[model samples]
Target: MTEPAQEPPFLQDPYAPYAAMRSACPVQSKPVDSGGRPGCLVIGYAEAREALADARLSKDTAAFFDGRGSRRRLHPAVSRSMLASDPPRHTRLRKLVTRAFTTGAVAELRPFIARVTDELLERWSPGERFDFVAGLAVPLPVIVICELLGVPESDRADVRRWSAALFSAGEPDVVDSASYSMAGYMTDLITDKRLHPGDSLLDRLIAARSGDERLSEDELVSLAVLLLVAGHETTTHFLGNAVLALLQHPDALGRLRENPDEIPAALDELLRFDPPVSTATFRFSTEALTLGGVEIPAGVPVQVALGAANRDPERFPAPDLLDLDRDATSHVAFGHGIHRCVGAPLARAEGEIALRAVLHRFPGIRLAVPPERLEWRRTRLVRGLASLPVLA
Candidate 1:
């Protein structure tokens, strides 16, 4: 993997590289490419979707390194989580948690979501510049997820810290420390839930049934950790990304302000315009295959750029433009296939509520600094602002 210099153009804005890759070739196989992965970078929408659903592309990282003498060790919770495992194992884990994250279950949280948005917005002082990320985006989703998982309010900060470390680029040791700490914490949390069950999703998982089977202790804890991390991280970035997109595109922002009803549809366009996840998690090829005319070999790591695919000209007309009226339901911002995000409903609800409330509360909100001064996160796996400064 190649790490770019601080403040590389690609880090600040990846669309240039994405477009260039799509124009030149749908897929590129070389270590020194924009994505910096050893195998292939799939930039086309169709290629990305196919790669996502292809059984030949494995999610099992452990299996990739089974025969190799790599000294790297992964946390059990991470290795065993559904995101990291392939079918049967992935199927079982997903079955246990899918019900709790279904549309109806998330719909019930709308009132609670509004309450949180109101509480956060009420904190902003009129005419003062504030960091949207710190003041709202970062805290809101974490608070919601913690509440759903029955985590103590006091422990939310630690959860946020660990979650941030897991996704932040640099220092494998930092990722390891965060993973281990979270795993240990989740283990204790699961044990407590087993003894004192509640209405929380974590409590339900502790007792979730699959005919004659139940989740094993490790599975239970790992699933909780997955839900906790995946639940908040993506949503947090998306909120910031969506807001930033609006600030940059005044017409789009004005359209939403005029027709508040457009927030949900507008969100889909915003996500496609600048997705929170730059790429899906690494997928290892189980066997040699051809993708977008490029040949990929078995066991090679592949990076499917979601942000790139969302903007493919073949799939989206005027792909770079943020048009809320455009058909954007097909965007793969949440990924695709059997491993598609289970928390999508909750994310959409949070995005809708948060965006509507933010716009309603501050109709004149604008970037506190010049667009050129903004800094994007350095991680390749996820795309978002380091901080979003705005005046309300």
Candidate 2:
């Protein structure tokens, strides 16, 4: 089995390693992301797309850790979520969620979203320097998702802290604690929602769980945690990446500024250019499968490089250039097939609103430090700027 070099391939730019892998070995057994688990990396566009849609490639964590003895399971609140389950369970969880996140439901939040964006912009005055992450990207989605989940405004900070620790590349003990704490918090929240059902998404879910035999208590808790985390993390990073991309490509930024109508299309291209979730969560083969002429054994984990596939020359012309007009709808940024991001509509809306507001508020916004001085999150699952200082 081949392993990546000691120095993490994605530390600075993951594309180089991804390009090399796509060209030299599109599908090869390799060490899994950061955790040193056995797996394969699929970088080619076609192969990655096929792998994402392949049913034989299971999302069950139990299948992955079946024979690992002591390393048997993840916290149920995370492992049982729709993202990590196959057909029946995933289908059930997604169906209940679809009722709450329909297009019309998400579209109705446009006014609330705009209000949040305007409120965030009020932080920066003319010529003031502010952190794009802290002032906008991070809090915007956090507040929106928290409100939707019926989380008390006073408790949002604690939720954010718990989430950060849960998703970080930190100590194992700390990660475990965060997971336990979040699981406990979500359980209590659901119990409270049952007694006091408000007109919120969580209330709807609680009703579904109680009224019909729609889901178990565990599934209810897991789904709630999934929505809360997935709702913000991807969008948060996408905003940071999108802003940085716009700053680097002045022509594209200028085009959007001149024609606000193009903001929607520009957001699509930005997602394709620099996806927030660099690689998909994880997929394991249920049986031996052949991909790119390589045979993957049953139970081996697989990670599809969504960012690399989005930039594949075969799939997108002038893959390296940031063309706001490019038709990037087929990009696997939100993933492919049934497992694609359920909150994609919300994320897109937030992206357009956030970028549009930022540009309008500060047409002169520019990076405060040299590009090389910027720090990237060290986790392999995501690609995001830790902080984006901007002079507006």
TM-score for every candidate vs. truth? Answer: 0.95, 0.94
- Output the worst ten-in-a-row residue range by lDDT, candidate 1: 1-10
> Where in model 2 is the C-alpha error above 4 Å?
1-9, 33-37, 70-73, 209-213
Q: All models: lDDT?
A: 0.86, 0.83
Tell me the tens digit of each residue's lDDT in model 2 across 244-277: 9999999988888889889987777999899998
| Residue range 1-392, candidate 1, lDDT tens digits | 23223477777778888898789999987562334447788999999999999999999876675555545455888756789899888987888788878889898898999999899999896677898999888999998999999999989999999988888676667787888999999999888877888989888887766663488888888888999999999998999999998999899898898888988877788889998888888778889999998888888888899999999999998998888889899999999999999998999999999989988889999998877677777663888888888999
Record all residue pairs in model 1 with backbone atoms less than 3 Å apart, i.e. clashing: none
Report the number of the highest-lDDT candidate.
1
- Root-mean-square deviation of every model: 3.4, 4.3
